[model samples]
Target: METTMLPAIVQVLPGDDFTVYAYCNDGAVRLLDAKPLLELGGIFESLKDPAFFRERLTVMNDTVAWDIKGNRDETCCIDLDPCVIFRTAPIVDDPLENVI
Candidate 1:
């Protein structure tokens, strides 16, 4: 999948990080800032499915879905407080030293 065809908002199910790469059907790579790719599918596994706005979503627009396999964290709703890793970096005085 080409980058231009990719969707703007992606919601990862569970066990997803920014480093994870989402490969579209047409061979486009998109780096998710948060959990854009749903974690329903297993990690380190190849997922095969049509792109949808949400899981169990019937309407198919330009969103890219997955059917991968591997390790994954199962959570229904994402928590904003506890899941600090997903949130933006905290304010820090040091620029280079504070890198995650």
Candidate 2:
């Protein structure tokens, strides 16, 4: 029998065009496109601002999240499920490979 482990997000980097680079525990960098979600309106309205989006990007609840209020309040912020991201997002090259 084999056991499967889900990847956990360790870091997040906001990219241009509403994309996010999620670094996972399994050594994978996944790219998440947030443009469609931002266009949904409602709670996501605050994320439409590119500056706010990049500034607030963070890791919360063990996943890619936004500390919208800057308080680190998990419940008040927006977060994406790690499993969803690991499964749905395509693995991408680390954007900081040359920087660090």
Return the top candidate by TM-score.
Answer: 2
Off by over 4 Å in 2: none
Name the TM-score of candidate 1.
0.21
lDDT of each: 0.29, 0.92
> Weakest 10 consecutive residues, lDDT, candidate 1?
52-61
Q: What are the clash counts of all predictions, listed in order?
A: 19, 0
**What shift in Å separates residue 37 of candidate 1 from its native position after superposition?**
10
In candidate 2, which residue pairs get closer than 3 Å at backbone N, Cα or C atoms, i.e. clash? none
Candidate 1 residue-wise lDDT, 1-100, digit = tens: 6545322223323223333233333333333333343354444122223232223321113232232222222232222221222233232222223567
> Which segments of candidate 1 are over 4 A away from where they belong?
1-17, 35-100
